[model samples]
Target chain A: MTPQLEILITVVIVSSACAALGVFLILRKMAMMTDAISHTILLGIVIAFFITKSLTSPFLIIGAACMGVFTVYLTEMLKRTRLMAEDSAIGIVFPFLFSIAIILITKYAGNTHLDVDSVLLGELVFVPFDRLVVFGRDIGAKSLYVMGTILLINMLFIAVFYKELKLATFDAALASVLGFSPVFIHYALMGLVSITAVGAFESVGSILVIAFMIGPPVTAYMLTDQLKKMLILSILIGIVNAIVGYWISAILDVSIAGSIATIIGITYLFAFIFAPKRGILAMIHLRRVQQIEYAVKSLLFHLYNHEGTDIEKEESNRHSIYKHLHWDKRFLERVLKKAARRDYLSVNKEYLKLTPEGRKYAIKSYEVL
Target chain B: MMFLESLLRDYTLQIVALGSVILGAVSGILGSFAVLRKQSLLGDAVSHAALPGIAFVFLLTGVKKTEMLLLGALISGLIGAFIIISIDRYTRIKFDSALGLILSSFFGLGLVLLTYIQKRPNANQAGLETFIFGQASTLLKRDVYIMIALGGIILLVVGLFWKELKLFCFDCEFGKSIGFSDTKINLILSSITVLAIIIGLQSVGVILMSALLISPGVAARQWTDKLSCMVILASVFGMVSGVVGTLISSSVAHMPTGPVIVMVISVIMFFSLLFATKRGILWRYIKTRRDSRDINECKILINLYESALNHEEVRHAHKTTMLKPIKSLHYLRDKGYIRRDYLNTWVITDLGMEKARNSIDKNRGERV
Candidate 1:
């Protein structure tokens, strides 16, 4: 495969794996934990490298993965004390651990290939050079195989435990009552998140891992409510982000991972503005519509309440609502027009009257209120 | 003594240490409010978000001056803070998701801008990466002055608003009910926190700045229950870590000052977690052990007293298998709580009866 294709494939696999786990994380309200894990895993990898003296050793992966879990463990331990909130707990632990790793790398391992820069901003341009060869047959980039395997593991884990995970995520108490250990499931999922973070670290670095893990899932969440659909949509969104981000980076000659993160941010922005039910636009429109309906109903109630009374003869008029209800002229006109179109009320010269249907609607609204 | 002498005599070391100490103390004071408000990660978000401002200022001016870059960082950090607050207020997305989104996206933009600058022939971006992993040793006397000025301003603001901030954190609803605008207090508090983060950005960098802000407060929490005391202790912890970390890193080759400081604070936090008087793990463990031991001892004494009440003599052979073994009875005998009579049965002494009565009273009090 071409180098571009290789990079794209690897990015997609990593993004999808992260996005899938992100679905669970978002549902579990543990999305920021990915950021914490991504960072603290560096300390794990650095310590592991110090012991084995080889970056390629599986011990590095194990060590980094252990640090990821350790980050979660420490965050939880701090949170359990009730002295601080969850985010504070995370904010405290990861940086302390990550700083340790950076210091260690810059101090003892400075002469080596290890440094804080590459750990935080992995170069995709270098991925193609490190190809895996089995029995003298050249294969794809090492990142591709590594990320591919991680994606498979994520898929398999989610698939097998989908029901239990869904149950635990949505209703932990009920799941526990049904014999599923919510805490066990929680740690297991965290373990998978750790492994995925470790796999993605070398390719995308840590910050973008948070981007891919949280962005697509949250965007999908804004777009949909169903878990199954959210998972699928997030994966699809991740693939698009990977592919589009790759091309943009290629054209602009910029950091591929960074471009990918920027693309996901843009995607989230769009979802935030334009998603059908939960989007800002929809919410505004819904509020506006509700306001109009409310104005019309209250107008009808006003007419109904004052009907056949001397007060109605004294104060009730078509233009009086603008003064009495303290509504703007434009708002009153709009409400009047809507109410007339709906046959809820009619205007006769100077006074307004509610139709029988409008009377019923007014009474119902009053009863409900 | 030598370390203290070197700390005072070495001008460069003194400048760096002074800068770190100010950064640590300010971060600690603001961090307590941040941690209590559950906005601990805001420091992380705002600091990371400040990166773009640094890059933008460097790009626009082609200068790498500390104050100018920090101005840009402050603006950017405030913008990031604004984005987080707006996202939270405007959208259904939770605070955590909004934080992660802003943090990664802003940092990503920063990386892009940084790389863009690095590619330019005119931009000498060698020192730019220092803001990611801070190099405290690189700080100049001028930078220290700037930090001190900023730190003083921050401390002044905190001191002046101490009562309002305390009420705002402890019970915001009460503060609001009493005519303090919660929104205004929140805005002021958030602004100060971002400022504290921006001042520390050059010393600790973005990644670990949150640690500077958060760890001190957490450690201090273990040692005190009062907010004012916690804030004071946190600052003290922060200052100690700053001095010690700077000294240690200066003595060692290639040791980064920021992480070393973080490491020192972390050590303090760990110890506080384990050994603080009121809420430390060690004290809680000791209390648990002591309470259980008291119950066991009380049970044994009460059983012996009951056996004596039933019969003229409390026989060691009496079926009190539910109680501790015969060795405990022997232990009570040795302690003079029980005496072996002519029949080889255990008899409660007057002192033992009084002890049993006290134990029963204590148990009853606890139940009540």
Candidate 2:
């Protein structure tokens, strides 16, 4: 396979893994925690690198994972103190840890190969340079294996604990009573997220990792109601994002991670505005139709209530009805026109009179409303 | 005295420290309100959102004028803040997801633009990326003046609308009920927060700026429950960290100021959480332990007295195994509430009986 395909595959694998685990994160209202973890894991990787003094050491991944979990633990501990709000706790802890890491890099590790830019804005174009050679045999890109393992781990975790995770996410108290420790599942899920973050860190950087994690999941959320379908949809969206984002970045000669993040944002914006049922435009359209329907029903009711009454003329006049109903004159006219078109009311001598069909319609609306 | 003399002699140090102090003080004041209103993450989103603005401005002007770039940032940050508000308010998306989405995507766009500008033949040294991890030691005197002016304006706005802001932070529904427009008040609050963030960004950078906004507010919260005191304490914390962080970074080789300031403020937050007088973990733990100990002693004495009354005997021996609060038993003996009668038993003294009766009467009275 060519290098471009290899890079694309790396991105897709990373996105799929992130999006898969991200479903549970967003459902648990932890999108921001993922943000906190992604940034803080840099600190962990730095510390681990210092210990092992090797970028390729497995300890870096382990340290990143540990630090990700530690971020959640510290935020929760601070929140449990009830001295500050939850988001404030996250805002405090991650920056503190990340700052320490940055400071360490700037002051002590400046001479090392580790560059802060790579930590923030990872360059996937360099993927072809780092080939995995096993026993002097040429293999694939190293990111392929790392991200693939993370992807498999995420899938296995979701598959093995599907029911438990579902129960725990929706209702933790009941899940706890039913013999599944939600706390354990929670920590385990966070651990996987951190691991995925570490694996993807090289390919997409820390900040863009959030785009992969949350973008596809939220977009899927906009498109689907079923959890299984949402998870599958997010994975597909992640794949598409990786492909489209890579192409855009390649064409523009810009940052691939940035392009991918922008694509994710645009995709979610599209879903937000144009999804069939839940999209903003669709809801707005539904509200407009509902408004006209309700207004016509109001006209029917008003005409039916005053039918053959002493004040029927005074109440049923279109110009006067707007005032009586506290609606705009133009709106009352629109409602009147709608009622007449439906044969629910007849206008004669500038006063509305309910038709025989109109009387029945008013009674039906009364029952339904 | 030597340090003070050095501070006076060093022109760049004076400028950077002064800028950091102003940035810290204003952000701290506004951050207290943000923390109370649960908008701590808003500053993070706004700061990141400002990046595309700066880069875009530089792309257009081809010159890195701080004021022009900051103006672009202000516009961009406001738009980002508005989008976050709209997403959270109109859609089913929660506040946190909206924040994370906006910050990352905007930062990414900024990166794309920065890289784009760098690739241009005439782009020259964009140096635009430095805003990500701001170098406080490079702050100019003009930047310090801008920070002071903006800082003063923020302070004045906060003072002028103190009552409305307090109402908005603690009780928005009540404020709405009393005829303050919720949207208007929210606009004022977010505007000040955005300005404060803009002022701090050049010193602390985008990523750590949130810490500057949140840690001081949270640290001050541990010290006091009142909003006025909390805001005052928070600004003081911010200034101290700013000054100290600057001093330390200036002394150390290859040290960037933003992270050091973040580290210093975090230490302050950690200590505040640990040792604050009212809400600190240590204080609460001690209070709980002492309360439990008192309750245990009261129960042991009350048990001896009740058993004596039941047996119709002045001296009733109780098993040491049954009354298992060994430490409380020793304390009761020391307090003259009970006495050792046998190897495995103890009896309530007259003093213990009277005390238990009075305590039981008081409990009954309170319940009634």
> Which tens-of-lDDT digit does each residue in B219-279 have in candidate 2?
9999998999999999999999998899888887878899999999999999999999978
What are the iRMS values of all candidates? 1.3, 1.0
lDDT of 2 by residue, A1-369 (tens): 799999999999999999999899888988899889989999999999999999899999999999999999999998998888899999999999999999889877988878888978888888877888999987999989888998999999999999999999999999999999999999999999999988888878977799888989988988988999999999999999889988999999999999899888889889888998888899899988899998888778877888889998799886688888889888877877787888988887777788899999899889987
Name the 10 consecutive residues with the lowest summed lDDT in model 2 chain A. A316-325
Which residue pairs clash in candidate 1? none
- Show model 1 residue runs off by greater than 4 Å: A291-359, B176-181, B294-319, B325-368
Model 1, DockQ value? 0.60
Global lDDT for candidate 1? 0.86
Query: Cα deviation in Å at residue B327, candidate 1?
Result: 8.8
User: What's the residue-level lDDT of B111 in candidate 1?
Assistant: 85
Question: Model 1 over residues B173-231: C-alpha lDDT tens digits?
Answer: 89989999876787788788888988787778888998898889988988888999989
